[model samples]
Structure formats: C-alpha cells, structure tokens
Target: MHIPFFRSFSRIREPSIAPEPAAEPAPRLGGQLERALGRTVALLQYTADSHDALDDVFTEIDGRSRTVIEELDTMRTTMEQSRQSAQDKAQASIDRLSALSQEAIDSLTQLSADLDKRMERIGAVMETIERSSSELSLLAINSGIQAAHGGEAGRAFGVLATRMRNLAERSSLDARQVAKLLDFSPFRASFTQFNTTLAHSIGDADRRISGAFHSMSASQIDMAARMDEIEAHTRAIPDMLANARDAIERGRRVLEIAQAGCAEMQNACHGPRALAAAAQRIGAPTASGVSVLDSVRGRGVLRVAIEPRAWGMSFRARGASQPRGLDIDLAQAFARRLGVAVEFVERPWLECPWLLMAGADAGAAADVMWSALVPAPIFHRVAFSDPYVHFRYVLVRRQGEARFTDIGSLAGHTLGAMPDPAVPDLLHAHGVRWGRDSLQAGVPRLKNLLIFPSLTEVFDALCAGRVDALLLEQTMAGWVCAAPDSPWSGRLEMQAAAPSDPVFHYTVGVCDDSAADTMREELNAFINGLHSVPDYGQLLKRWHIEPAQVQPTLQ
Candidate 1:
C-alpha cells in the first residue's frame, strides 16, 4: 500500500517479513512477526507526530502570509492616496504660479500704458514750449532790427532782444532732448517680449507636470493590478494548506488501521506487550524555528536609533545619563508594548538608515530609527512606517531685524540652511538664489547660501550675523527661540507670513529586510494607537510639535 504519511520517512528502510522456513519452530516464527509488527507500529506513531508538527507549521505560515498580504494592500492604498495628494498639490501650485504670472503681466501692461499716457502729455507740453519759443525768437529778431533804425536808444533794446533770443534757443534745445528721452516704444517692446516668454514658460511647465502625473498614474495603476494578483495568490495559500492538511489526516487514518493490524499481530504472539513498549519509545517533536517577533521578545530589549541633537524631536541634555525628547517618550512607549527595555543608540541623522541596513552583522544595528526624519531620496533603501507627525519650513531671523519677512525677502541676502539636498530647490522656488561655489547651468545666480552642518551651527551663524536669515523647520525654530533655557531664546523670531511649503511627514524607519517587517508593523500599530491617547497630544505639546492629522484607517 502507498503511504503518503511516510514521505518524510523515506530514508528508513521498510522492515521485511521473511517467509517461514520448513525447519523453523512456530513460536520462533511468531516472535519474529511480533517484533516486526512492533517496529511498524512505532514508525506509524512517529509519522502521526510529524504530521501534527507539519500541520502547525503550515497554519503559522498561512497566518503570516495573510498578514503580509494585508500589509501590502494597506501600503498600496496609502501610496495611491499619497500620489493623489501630491498631484492635487502640484496642480494647485501650478495654478497659483499661472495666476501670479498673469498678474505680473497685467501689472506690467498697465504700467506701460500709464507711461505712454504720461509721455504723450509731456510731448504735448514740449510742442507748446517749442511754439512759444519760436514766437519769442521772431519777436526778438524783429525788435533787434527795429532798434537798429532808432540808433543810441535802440542799442539798449538790441541788447535785451539778444538776451531773449539766447534764452529762447536754450529752451528749444532742452525741449528736443526731453522729447527724445520720452520715447516709450522700446520699453513697451521689451515688456511685451518678457510677458510672452513668461507665458510660454508657464504653459510649458504646466504641460510637463501634467504629463508626468499622467505617466505616474498609469504606472501606479499597473502596480496596483500586480499587487492585486499577488494578493489573490496569497489568498489561495490557506486553501492549499487546508487541502494538504486533509491529505495528512487521511494518511494518519490509514496509518492508524495499519497500526491496528500490527497490534493484532503483536497481541496474537506477545499479548500486547510489544505494542505497549513501542508506545513508550516515542518522544515529543522539537519546535520549528523562532520568528523575528519571538526573537525580539526573547532578547527583552529594543534598540532605537536616535540623533541626539534634534532639538524638540530627540536630544540629550548636558550631564544627563538618559536622553530625552518626544521620540524618547514614544520609543519607551513602544518598548513597553513589546515588554522590553528601550536602548537608545546614538547615531547621526544621515547614518541611521545605513546602520539599520547592516542588520545583525553590525554590532550597533538598530531595531528602529525614531529620529525626526522625513522621507527623502537619500533614504530610499529604508522602509518607513506611517507618519506620526507633520512639520513645515519657516523663515527665521534675528529679533529687531524686519528685513526678512518672507521667503521673497531672502533674495540678495545670506541665508543659512541645514545641509539637505532639498534645501537648494526650496530656496530657489522662493526666489532665493543658491551660492554654491561650483557653477551649474540653469542654476540661479549666486546671492549667498551657507550650509551649516547642524542646527546648532545654523542658529549660531544667524545670531552672529553671518547669515541674514535661516530656513528651518517650524518645530525646531519655535523650540530654540522660545524655550526658556535655550541660548537663542528671545534673540530670534520666525518671520511672519513665511511660506510653509514642503511639509515634512516624519515616520519611523527600519531596514528593508524581511526580518524587520514585523518590527515595522508593530511600530505602525503603536503609532496608530497613540492618536486615541491624551498623553500623545500632551507629549507633542510639550515638545512644541503640532500633531498631524491621523489617517481614517489608522484612526
């Protein structure tokens, strides 16, 4: 009989029952049969035990696979939503830019028209002056000629006429120069060309942006369809596992019948003694490999990567044994959920992602990075959890300095910014020119751009007058300028009405390895849970951070 249950037992040779020899005694032959029966019964029992273990493994794998599918679905949905939001924002920005450009053109046209009207009025005045000067010259010439006929008395009149004639000539010459300078046609043509170029540029930008978003939408649709196919495959796994389990069950029943036959044969020879002893030989099966979640629980510590000088986000005070900040509190809370102690790993802002990617191979690998980091191109390799907070950039200036009121005011002034690749684009978008030493085509003309290594240095430069203004995150700016213990407290203030573009959605980062998926999920759950707790809001308020709106799904 074919025994599917014995697939894992392929290495073990089937016991052979030899036909009885004519010289062999009946009792000895019976004993041989009984011993073989006992061995077969033992093998069947081992197969059943292995089947149970295999069933458990299949169930666990099915559950994990389902969870993975659900997470992927959530990710796909979130990505679609993010893409839609970005497209909407881009469109709104494009519309605003178009409107501003049109406004500029309208204002230029009106200015040109006003200048033309003024020039016309001036020209008319010049013509009137010319006519009066010509009449006065004619009168002076006639008086000079008539005074010559009146001899000595006429000599004085001749001198007066000569003075009047000289004055008329000078007035006429001045009028002609003024009239020539009043010509506005060239100015009007230059204005028209500028307006046309601006309109063309705006239209081209609009088309490019539209095409990009259209292509992105198409790509996202394709990705979504692929994800759906993957989910369908994932959904089929449990059924496949169920069918396998049923086959194992049927094999177990067949083994049970074979075991009965073995029992009967053994009983007929040894009165159930051999079968009872065989049952005593079977031991419990060893457990399957531990999961990443179980491993973390076993270790009892969750290492969190943190940048210590992130102002209101995460930081360590002087002489303090433990670090403190909004992220610290959140990390401790996450550790509490995991039933583990929180271990803070000191790392630079840019190095945290690399450390996580190193995984267990690195001595200082982190389970999660909870610093105030935003999703940027540099961190493409890292997987990020849902955003827990949102922040925007602001223009900061020294107190009593009213020159820097908005991003537009930053033009022609030295501006301090953190060393971020996105800073240049952000500045240039707001009409501030980048001043990098290396010349690049299409780059704005250098005004003054100073990149500081850290927020501390940036603030120091602003205070020391090395930089006229600073582009900083609103939370950090508020914390530094308003915190009672801060050295910059009361010395600087944020410029009112500053543009708040490029809002940052700060999220928890982890290595992209499959091993970290469980950790990422756990973190996402923890973050989602925080919204309902009053302490979370209080923590944000304490840190001067404005809590972001929680997504409906997370809520």
Candidate 2:
C-alpha cells in the first residue's frame, strides 16, 4: 500500500495588460494635432514688460500646481478612512452570525443525546413487563395442578387456572409490543400504546426542532453572505476614498508649486518689463525717428496681452514651417505691419482689462489686446477684429487608462485642478450638481474636485501617479505634450470638451480711446493682409497651428 501517492498539475493563465481601443474619428484626431500647434503660438505671443514678470508668471503657475497636488493627497486619505470604517462594521456582523450558527449546532447535538436517554427508559419498562408475564404463566400452570387434586372444587380451580393463563398470554403480547416501541403503558400489565405514542411525540418534537434548526441555519448563511458582500463593498470604498484624498493632496502640492513658481515668474517679468519701460522712456531712436509709432504714420501701437510663460503653450504636428498658437503671432505681426510698436502686457485669467486699458474711454493704457479674449470682451467693451484662434480646456490622465472616456468619467476618480471661481460657477450655471451621488446631464463630469492653484502641478501629479488627471485647455495641453524636448511628449493626451461647454476663443480687445477710429481701421486692414503674407502664414504653420485635416488608413 502506498501511504502517499499523489500527482499534481496546474494550468495557469498569463497576466495581460489592457489594450488601446480603435482609433477615434478622423476629425477628432485632426483636432488633437491642431490643438497641439496652438501651444507653440502661445509661446510666441509672450513678450513681457520685463524678464522678471515672465519668470514670476512661470513660477506662480508652478507654485500653484504644487499646492494642488498636496490637496489631492489629503482627499485620498479621508476616503481610505471611510472605507476602513465600513469594513470593520461588516466584519462585526459576520462574527455575530457565526456565533449564532454555532449555538444552533450545539442545541441539535444535545437533542440527539436526550433522544437516546428516552429510548433507554422505554427499554427498562418493557423488561419489567416481560418478567411479570413469565411469573403469571407459572402461576397458571401451578393452579391447574392443584385443581386436579381437588374433586368438586377442581372446576373452580380449573376456571381460575384458565383465567390466569389467559392473563399471562395477554401480558406476554403487551411486553413484546412494548419491546418494539419505547414503552409508555396505560395498563399495569403492559405499556405498549402509551410508549408508542410517547415515541411518536418525541419524533415530532425532533422533527420540529430540526425544522427550526434548518431555518436558523438558512438565516445564518444568508447573514454571512450579506456580510461578505458588505465587507467587499466596504473594502473598495476605502480605496476609492483614498484615491479621492490623494487627489486633494495632489491639488495642494500644485498650489504650493504654483505659489513658488509665481514668485519666480514675477521676478523674471520685473526685469523684462523694466527694460521695455526703460527703452520706451529713453526713446531709442528708430530709423523713422518716431518716438512711438503714431497712428498718423500708419496703423498705430497694438497692445498685445501676453499669457505668462508659466501658463505655457504647445507645438503640434508639422506642416509648412511656422510657429503655433499663431493668433498671438499674427497680432504681433499686425502691430508691426501697421508701423506700430507692440506693448505686450501680462493679463489675468479673467480680467484682461486690469492688465491693459482695453475698454476704458479716457485713461486707456493700451488700444487693443491680442492674447485670447472671448467675444464678450469685444462685444461689451469694443468690437473685435475677428476671432483669430480657438482653444479648449481638456482633462489629462495616465497613459494606459481606458476607464476614463471623457471628463465625466472622472466622477469616480479623484480630480485635481486649480480652484477657479468661474469653473464651479459655470457648472452651477448649467445645472451641474456638486455631490458624489448626484449626477445629471449637462453637469461637469467630476463633482469631487481637488482644486489646485495652477495646471502645471496638476500635470506633474498625474505623471507622478499622485492624481488621476489634470484639467487644462485642449489647445495648450495638446501642443505641450507633443513639443520637442518636452517631457510630456507622447505621454499625454487631450480630452474633448463636453457639448455643455462654451466655446473658448481668442479675439482682439478694443477701447474707446482717441485712437479708436484709426486703431479699428488699421486692425481690420491688417487682418485682411495677415493670411496672404508669407511670413505671417509661415509663422502660423511653423507652430503647427493650422487647422486642416487628413485621413489616415485604419488597420
């Protein structure tokens, strides 16, 4: 005999990674490239008043980004705590259910022992009945013998003997029946019927007990199953909450980074702006001997709003050689072509007028602002030259994340971004909700946001696995991701804006200053000539900012 003879074999499956989906629609793909080109144009547009200011803007953006990252981390921690609490509660329930099941098992075991004892008691009663019946049969035999000895009285004796024999026979039969059933007799001679009824009653009790036991078992099993499910849910919840907390911490980090970056950018912009101001004050002589390019000479001075370097831009796919984010470039070219010196000023995210005097009538600082101003800025303040460029805000995530199809998909994930009053307000405007369970159409995809100070930190955290994604304009994100020497190249992607979003535009800002009439005429004329000029168009194309599409073969 072989005490230990066994064969074991295992067939295991190899682990696999997730695969990318089929290519997107041709139009969307082209849009991604076009947006990339826009970033290059944004860079070309930055002409700060001083190097210090340029540096400050970049530093500020970074500082804010770092702060945001920290916030994301905190949010993740909170979520984990919540999940752990739920798991503990579920575990306690499971323990209690197990104890109840054990109690039921013990009760059943005791009932089995009691049943055995009852059977033994009935056996003893049957033994006594058997002994009594044997003794009665002997007496009958003796009575018959005595009757034979007596003559006339023998009849009575014989009768008595017969009666005794009959009683013995009946007693014996009763003992045999009691032996078969657990004896609980009604008669002194035998307890067969009573014992049989007792046995039946015991069986009924056992059956009832079994039924109750079975019910209890079922209930315990169900309770355990429920606890298992609850535990699983609770476990997952902690991780989700952890992710959310991490996102918040990441946001805080972004803010810190942006704050530091802002300080640096401010230093950089200061020197550059001062230099420009000094040059202006000293009146560096131009060949034309114009202190400032007066409107009378040609078009006039065009005030260009420069998006700080901290914000940055992208360089998309190559076409004809040109810089990207070409609208900013065109604005500069338009200013130069009109024989006007460009006064580039840094503009705030929302209020460009504060940076430059665009809409004011009397104390206006700059006649026109170029950067990316919406139509509202133009319509309310002054007429726009035209919409020179378009942009979008996009969400960026890890490279292999297929779970997120759109920004809305981020609802389950921790989202890190700078807290812009405009963002939440915009969501509120479109009836977007602000709770974890609250989801509806037209709402921004992420209700749980880890707000940061700047977008750069958001990107940093995403790359570092601190947060799931970063939010920014598609045009900027796309270009920066593809730019040469950019670390994010090929590792980043753009998410399309939802239909509920408003169009992002870059337009010319105008003012009602004395130079308004001349400024308007020159700007319109400059735009008409901008596209046809080789240098201007070449600049735009160089930046990969051209908006054209070409289809690719699908595999």
Candidate 3:
C-alpha cells in the first residue's frame, strides 16, 4: 500500500499538452553539470597526456638503444674488414720474404760450387809449372858439365849454365809457394758451413713468421666468430623493441578506454546533478540558524523522530516488532557509529518536522527528524541534510479502466492524493488544472481533485471508484500494484510517468539553528562516508531500494 505521508510531494506534469518553452535563461543546474563534466574531462585529458609523455620517453629509449646497436654492428663490420685486410697483406709480405730467403740460399750454394771448380783447375796448373821448373834445372846441370870438358873456351859457357841452374831452382821454389797460396780446400769448407748456417737461420725465420701468421689467423677467426655472434644478438634487439613498442601501444589503448569510461561517467552524472540542483533550489532556505547540534550529547542516547506508519519506508517489522525499513536501518547504523543507543520517538509524519524545531528549554523533542522531502515553505522553518534518495511520480488506475498512460489521460479526470504541504502547489505547477486555489480556503471543491486525510482513505476511495486515478511515487505504486494484500494490487495498473526530471530529494530535517547546521553537516559527512563503502550497496539491496537512488546524495 502507498504511504500517504511518504508519497512524493512534487507535482507530476500533465502530458496532455506540450509544455511551452519558457523565455527565462536555462537553469543553473545545467551550468553546474557542465562545469562538473568539464572538470572530469580535463582530468581524463591530463591522464592521457601523462600516458603520452611516458610513451614518448619509452620510444626515445628504444630508439637510442637501436641506434647504439646499429653503430656497434657497423663498427664490428669495419673492424673485421680492416683486420682481414691487414692479415692478408702481412701474409703476402711474409711469403715474399720467405721466397727471397730461399733464393739467397740457392745462389750461395751455386757460388760455392763454382769457386771449388776454379780452385781445382788452378791447382792442376801449379803442379804442371813445378815439374817444368825441375826439368829446366836438370838440363842446366848437364850443360855446365859439357862446357868444362871443352877446356878454357868452354869455361865461359859453363859459368852461364851454372847461373841458369840457380835461376831454375829459385823459380821452382817460387812456383811451389804460389801453389800453396792458391789452395781452395779450406775456403770451400768455410763457404759450405756459412751456407748451412744461412739456410738454418732462414728456415727458423720462416717458421717464426709462419707461426705468428698462424696465431694471428686463428685469433682473427675467433674474433670474427665473436663479432658474428654479437651482430646476430644485436639484430634480435629490434624484434624485442618491437614487442616492447606493441606492449606500450596496448597500454595506450587501455588508457584510452579508461579515458572513455571517465567520459561516460561524466555524461551519466549530468541527470543526477541537475536533479539535485533543482531540488536544492526548491527547498533552499532564505534565513537560517534557529537550531543547534547540542540536542544530542556525545555517546549518549539519541532521540530520533520518525513516523512508523508507512509499510516499507520506516515502519516496524510485524514478527520482530523491531524497526526494519531503509530509514530505520540507516538511523540505527548511524546511532551505532556515534556510540549511542537509539531512542525512537514515534510521531505523525506531517508533525515530525516540529520535533527538530522544539525549544532547548523544552528539551528538544528530537535530535534529528528524517527522511522527508521538505516543501519549499518548510525550508523557512527548518534546515535539511543533503538528500539520500530521490523519487519520481507514477500514475495508478484500475486494470480494466482506461490506462493513465500519459498526462493527457488525466487532463479532465479526477485525481486523488493524501493531503500534504507541497502537493497542491506541485499539482498547480504541473498544470494540473485545479478549480480551487487552496485546500484551507474553504471554497467550493473541485470535481477534478480529491484530497483525503490518510492513505487508507485514499486507497479505499481508489478501490471504490470514487477517484479516476491517483498519483504516487513510482516505488510506492509498484509495491501497491504488486502486493497481494493491498486492495489495488492486480486490480490497478501502475503506469510509469515520464518527464521525471525535477524529482524530489528526500532528506533529514532539523530546526534552523546552530545545532541544525552542525547536524546537517554531520549527517552529510556520514552519508557521504556511507556511499563510499561496499556495504552501501548491500544495505540498499537488503532493503530492496535502488542503489542508484542513493548515489546523488553525495555532498
């Protein structure tokens, strides 16, 4: 059943006629939403820029690493080529020197052989000359003897022959000394020893040079192999870099998705923020400071004023005889946090607001009063905390009756509602076409409207066909339309009303005093804190309240 006291006080627009555009400038709510969205967008942009900067840094590092690898590779190639060229030239020079050494050894051997042959020929000639000298000496001796036999005339001839014999002996002696001087046996032996030593020395030099070249060639091959490995490893670096770049690119894409999500959140916040702004404007007080927060002392029992008449709002549980509604649970949780026990003060819904306004000397009827959608006029007398929930109007009618599909359907039809402070004004504001100006004026009643004093009477009238249709909060109507115990259930068609903007934000109320301001601030802080917790959604779900409704309560 719909609670008469808890029904939304906002006037739902009649959709039969299109609303004409007002000449006034757009609401500040739009500007507020825009500024909020702009800030969110700016934050997202800043994040994207930061990501871009990081990407640029990584890209630079990758490029530098690549450049270093390339340079190393080029240097390795140049060094290998130079080393190979130098080794080739060195080997060629060694080969030429070895060839020149071999030629010198060969020429020395040939020269030694020629020298030996010439010495042998000279020795033979010396032998021949010696023999000839000997023969001449003998001949000279014979001639000297014959001359002596010839007597005095032959004496001169014999003297000449003796002189010749002396010449021949001297000549033979000189020839023998020349043959000894010309001897080549010792020279040939000495030349043979020198040639052997030169050949050995040349061979040793060739071996040393070849060994050096062989070692150098081995070292060059090992170095070339190492360079090749290094080059191959360096070549793999670009692929690794490409993989890193791909990872960074993927990260960038993820960042972009995050930015897009932020944008979506920004867009979604608009409707809620606008609704909050509009509701605030509607109930914003012109004057304040008539209440204070001292109504409740620290860690002491709290006096919370609430109406327990509603079915699912703030009523007591049937079996447990304990309070079990969204508002009651919230209040109990809040009291627990304060280290205080709750002192529930039952009061009528409409009169609950006066509890906060009670005088200090009167012992302040209650520390806080909730959860009401205070009318604009009440704001002059009380202060309200930030809204914790919002509600939209819905149309309720009998199932077989003409559907109350739009505002047009209700244009000339009679509507029923439990009397409330803001209902008349809201109805008028929505072009409800009421014949009467005020309910308390005691004027002739309008055939198009029915104001009951209680929800029971309203429902009784709805079931009795005393009213064509009724307006209620969407949640309340849904409950009523579905509840088996309610008379309107199954028989009533609860059609959702559109143009749901400018919804009412329900809040806890306080007197316009110092305590009221403090209490409001504290309540806002507590509510804000509650929204941040995971249990916030759990609490809403436990009470079957929509979690989305509480999100706009953020101060």
TM-score of each predicted structure versus truth? 0.45, 0.41, 0.41
Instruction: Tell me the RMSD of model 3 versus the true structure.
Output: 32.5
Better of 1 and 2 by TM-score: 1
Predictions in order: lDDT: 0.64, 0.47, 0.56
What's model 2's lDDT at 388? 49
> Whose lDDT is greatest here?
1
lDDT of each residue in 326-359, candidate 3, tens digit only: 6787888887876778877766564455455331
- Once superposed on the true structure, which residue ranges of model 2 sit more than 4 Å away at CA? 1-303, 310-328, 340-343, 347-352, 358-367, 377-383, 391-393, 414-432, 435-445, 450-453, 464-467, 497-502, 512-514, 533-541, 544-555
Roughly what TM-score does model 2 have, to 2 decimal places? 0.41
Name the weakest run of 10 consecutive residues (lDDT summed) in model 3.
Answer: 1-10
- Judged by whole-model lDDT over C-alpha atoms, candidate 1 comes out at 0.64
Q: What is the lDDT of residue 354 in candidate 2?
A: 30
- TM-score of model 3 vs. true structure: 0.41
Candidate 2: RMSD to truth: 21.5
Candidate 3's displacement at residue 180, Å, is 99
